[model samples]
Target: MKDSSHPQATPPHPAEDVLDHLGYRLKRAHAALRGAMDQALREHGLTVPQYACLEVLAARPGLSNAELARATFVTRQSMNVVLRGLQDAGLLTRPATVEAGRARPASLTDEGRRRLNAAQGAVYAIEARMIETIPGERLSRLLEELDGMARALKD
Candidate 1:
């Protein structure tokens, strides 16, 4: 029994503590990764989202705005702003007239490829640094676990 006037301070449960919370740890890791990528991308005048769009466009060739929005985990309006910036910088292109649907499919330009190539080295280095922090034997498991977690939560 505890007194109502002066309640005892409860000891923290290790598993239930905020420091051990999965969501908190995930958010912290995400922020660290984003910050690192942002720093690496700043020299090239690119934001993390812009670089993500470029990377996706490079791999997929021609993706509609909405498709890109989904792939990048951004709103269509936000993606439009990113696309406009990239287009203005001559890093990507869209058809002057929509020949098929309302969505404008975007493709990387020669400059876009060049820029992506330039940034890839730095980005890969950052990834390598992160991977090096984990044990070699656990790397695959870590990746699989992350993918599984994401899949489980996606509804």
Candidate 2:
């Protein structure tokens, strides 16, 4: 017989418990990575969001702000803020589009491209240092699991 009135009478959930533990660890790891990357970028006058905007613009020149928002999984308003900061820094340019009446094409300047390229090594180093263990197979599996979770959540 079980005592339902007892606070400890509940059965432990294997799935939820594992997810909670993993989520906490993942958050902590992400915070640490973000902190290190932010510190590294500070000297260059860049934040994580700003760096991401530069990278995306460098990779896909002439992207509209809306398209950038979609690609970056950010709101258009939020991306506009990033664009403004980058533009103010002379790292990015948004020229009025000749093809469209009101659409502006976002592109990175030479300086922006150079900075993005320079940051790549630091980004790679951070990722490598963080995921140095757990083997390649496990890392791949973890990535797959995360992708699956993303897909499921999106639906």
Candidate 3:
């Protein structure tokens, strides 16, 4: 049916008690993590988005802006800006002209690798702190449930 092509988006109903809502708790955790990351990345002169792009590029080189944007949970436009800033900082490289299509592949330079490696310690420390807060046995189940929640929302 033609109606199948146009699915309606339904907003989630909020719980009566905001404090007891899963969304509230998840957002609080996210905000806390982001604040910590902001402080940690600031010491190394990188924003969270910038650091995310570098980390993703280091792991998988020669990814285009659109690909990087998807992998880093950012928009393609935002990724372009992040890539340009990194390139200007001598942390990464993008071709002057596209060798083929519109997508110009991006890769981290030696300095980018060095910077990411340095920033990893602080980032990892933050993760370690979070891990310590949760019970050891529950961590895996927590991750699984979080993944399930994300998948559910996507559907």
Candidate 4:
């Protein structure tokens, strides 16, 4: 017979509880940040997704839709819609394919570059406002942790 006084039990962990709890708070924080970005971009006639695409193209020119999708962490179909929208806006261009039966690779147009440049200050302002209260070291740690988490998740 088992002793009633001694019971098998799991260890207590407030850390595990707060892990998901803090995650929920982080999601809300991200939504707030995204909303601010969306509003700032809207003033310049761009959505957050479109701005992300523009930033990706600006950094790495001549990306195919597949590569762009990968960079944006979006599905190919969603990227196709983004590409079509940007193309329609004359903010991006796709060169005629050099290889047989291949689609043209995409790049940002001069106008797109100029617009992105113009919006740079506002974007920085939004980011700054969000992190302004945070200490530099704390912000650095937060960024490192977030990037590490993202890499882990990707893997």
Highest lDDT among the candidates is held by which one? 3
- Mark the regions of model 1 whose C-alpha exceeds 4 Å error after superposition: 1-16
Residue 55 CA error for candidate 2 (Å)? 1.1
Give all candidates' CA lDDT scores.
0.91, 0.81, 0.92, 0.84
TM-score for model 3? 0.87
After superposing candidate 3 on the true structure, give the runs of residues whose Cα lies further than 4 Å from its correct spot.
1-16
- Kindly list the per-residue Cα lDDT of model 3 for residues 31-66, writing each as its tens digit: 999999999999999999999999998889999999
- The superposed Cα distance between candidate 3 and the true structure at residue 36, in angstroms, equals 0.3
Q: What would the C-alpha RMSD of candidate 1 be, to one decimal place?
A: 4.1
Clashes of each: 0, 0, 0, 0
Q: Please give the distance, in angstroms, between residue 120's alpha carbon in candidate 3 and its true position after superposition.
A: 0.4
- lDDT string for model 4 (83-150, tens) is 99999999999865567556568888999998888777788998899889899889989999989978
TM-score of each: 0.88, 0.80, 0.87, 0.81
lDDT of 3: 0.92
Off by over 4 Å in 4: 1-20, 96-103
Q: Sort the predicted structures by lDDT, highest score first.
A: 3, 1, 4, 2
